[model samples]
Target: MLDAVVVGAGISGIYQLYRLRQAGLSVQLCEAGDGVGGTWFWNRYPGARFDSESYTYGYFFSRELLDEWSWSEEFAGQPETERYLNHVVDRFDLRRDIRLGARVSAAVYDDAAAAWTVTVENGERLRARFLVTAVGPLSEPYVPAIPGLAGFAGVWHHTARWPREPVDLRGKRVAVIGTGSSGVQVIPHIAAEAAELVVFQRTANWCTPINNRPITPERMREIRRTARTIHRTCQETPGGFVHRPLSVSALEVGEEERRERFQRLYDAPGLTMVLANYRDITTDRAANAAVTDFLRGKIRERVKDPEVAERLIPTDHTFGMKRPPLEDGFYEVFAQEHVSLVSLAEEPILRFTPAGIQTAARHYEIDVAVLATGFDAVTGAIRRIDIRGRDGVRLDRHWEAGPRTHLGLQSAGFPNLFFVGGPQSTTGNIPRATEIQVDWVMDCLRHMADHGHRYVETTPAAEEAWLAHVESTVRGTVLEDATSWAFGSNVPGKPRVYQLYAGGIPQYRARCAEAVEAGYTGFVFG
Candidate 1:
């Protein structure tokens, strides 16, 4: 038996375990993977890296950890990010309690036991007073329904489940499916190696330049000096990433002024336009069109081939509604002699032949197919496991409509069960949200201990009300215009409701504070 069992070894899970241990709790972190890094640990495609700036996309809890670890690029790649996470684990000596390669198959709470009985796939059983799920929002790999994908004779891998051994695509044809963030980032790198690369893209997202460069000693120093300010700025800002701090909405600005602002921010690169577009894009369809049109034009101008460029434009959805993708020289890769953009819309992939994939338009032969198809997002991780609470109510059935929890942490039926960076929390950049949420969970659990509460859970009524609030919050926003993982629209038959609180990080932090002030509102203690 342990005080807490965290069901992930990702960054959030690492933070949760470290904080809980610091709070005098005995914690055991079980991970399905053999090692740490969670999503980073797994996603090892060519050129997979963090799009968000590295200096900010990291843990803020330990100033020492931040200062001690160094990044290879302005935005750290997957390998370096994983290395940093491992470094933190070693620095804190946090590996003693973490059991790797042990996938938890079931976690059930017996009312009489007042503890969670966790059963692993290997028949190992453990009990814990508190259950924390650090399964990331983007943890689950989602391969689209491409026919005969299983029978492909050559190499096939998802970015999420990259092979440990090196893959050789030197003179072989390579096809990459899904041009989302992963595809955008990896395509150029893959195209450089593949004899000929075909990118089968369904939708074209607004791709911004990474503007990624090596982090200088001078730059690191400046960021370290202003770490507090950056954290504050991110908390106050709409997106988790630190961008323009805006007090006024853009709708209030005159057309000329707004266009000028848009021009300036658009040139600025990566998420600048998001805050600039914050004014009326969600409310004013014209405003949304103006920005989307600008992006479409930008994408069109980048590709060498006009026909290919036209196919890349996202006609249906507004910008930023779908998780905004940021990349460098993505469209330019199509100009390369080795690269070809396959329009999945016009010529849908019919099936995969034994040799390679085939579309209605052509029978292209390839040695490898890289599935950049993103995760099932928010709910997939939790759904992968059997979680039962209160009278053996299965979590799968409970979340049939969508995930429901108070403050994205504790579920109503499962007393002592906590989730870090889960549904109903900020889904932008996670490191920032992880810091705030971890702090709150730690403080809440401490409060429970101090008050001599043996058990605590969200009230059923409170969970329903909170779920409704999450759904309603995005109703008026531009997110409703299309299917996004944030709204659980990307995955087929998944609930249409959003998984994040869309109310900005500051408001989320404030509500959490208020909940603590109000004795953990929407929750009950015994």
Candidate 2:
């Protein structure tokens, strides 16, 4: 029996395995895929890239590793990112500890032994004192419930699960569905190759320029100088990206300055243009309008057809509520003669025909279809695993309405079972959140080991209190109104509770700290 077993070999899983190994713990990492790089390994579509940019969307644990790797682009594609992760595995010698092509089927807490017996699909059973689920937020792909999605005779693909080999869309009529981040990034590439590309937009999405360019050698060296400081500062930021150098808040800049910078910023691309309004865009309606309108005007200018441009511009939700998209010429691609936008709200998908898709308006024939529908997110991966706690109660049955856990890590009934990015996790608690979380779990494990403890679980009170706090946080912000995967609003039949903590990332850090300082208060340490 190993000391610990980690599920999923993504970025988080890789780091988790390394940390435990460095602590001289007996641990093994299991992945269902053939290799490492969880998301990067599967999503190999044309324009699939990271929104957080190249250098810092990686492990910051080792200075040598940080300094050694060189990024090929400002925002890395799926292939390049995969290579980097594989290199991390090779350089750190993480292969021996990893069991690839092995999917954990079920995990049950055996009260008699006080250990989790994990069963793999191939009938391999392994027991460990701790079972950590490092399954990512976007692990499972979601396909829409359109009447006849499977009936379409030709090729159909989800962006999340795109084919590993090259696809030929040239001279083929293609229909692309969904307008989220991946949809926005991929449409242009699809349009370029297809004879005619019809984009099905259920909701018009807000888009900012990616402004991606090759990271110059000179700039790379300069970043290397302050790499440690930058890495530390990013932990402090909300979304894990390096914030702009402007110290003053957007409100501090003048109106004229704001207008000029907003225009300049809008053109500059990446995330810099997201805040041209020079004020708080989240709560303040006017500030949010300023940013949204600027992007709308940009779309109008680039798209050739006025009707298509109007269809492309989103009017309903707040900017940050849904995951924001970034691209250089996504809007411009619509100007192409072969490209057209189909408003799904205007013309709902009636069904899929043998040769084409039948929207309410008309039937458009296509050779290939791209279902850019996003993942079930946050809850999907954990739900996929069959986890039974002390009473042989399933995690899914307990979470039928919604998911609930203390600190999104430990559940009340599940003793000795752990989750890395679990429910009730304060995701908004920026830079220090993940650092604080991993530390807390490790501390709990170490404490249990030293004291001859068997299994430590959260009290029902702790789970309920933390769950209420998470709900309150989500309802307090614009996030509650966000009808995206973040709130489980996109997928039907799933509970409508908030999956991530909307309170500021820094605030979350303090709460976790307080819990630890109070000797893991509310946790039942046996």
Q: Which model scores highest in lDDT?
A: 1
List TM-scores for all candidates, in order: 0.96, 0.95
Model 1, 1-526: lDDT tens digits are 7998999999899999899888878989999999999988999887888867777688888889767776667778888988988998989999998999989999999788689999889999989988988888899888788789889999898989998788888988999999989999889888888899999987778777666678788887888888888877777766677875455655667877867766777676456677645567655677777777777878877886888788878776878677677777788887888888877778899999999988888898989999988888888888888999999988889888888888888877888888887889865678788778889878877888889988888887888887777777777777766677777766787877778778777777887898889878888888
Q: Determine which window of 10 residues in candidate 1 has minimal summed lDDT.
A: 269-278
Per-candidate RMSD, Å: 1.8, 2.2
Compared with the true structure, all predictions reach lDDT values of: 0.82, 0.80
Segments of candidate 1 deviating more than 4 angstroms? 245-260, 276-278
Best by TM-score: 1
Off by over 4 Å in 2: 244-254, 274-279, 426-435
In TM-score terms, candidate 1 sits at 0.96
lDDT by residue for model 2 (1-526), tens: 8889999888878887887888888998889888898888888889999877677677777789878888878888899999999999999999899999999989999888889999989999888988998887787899888887778899999998887889999899999998888898899898889999988888887888887888888878877787888776666665555654344455666767767777787666456654333436665566666666666777888887899888888767867677678865788888788988888878889999889898778889989999998999888888988999988999989888888788877888999877776666746312235555666778888888888898898888998898898888756455667788887888888888888776555566677778878988878877
- Clashing pairs for model 1 are none
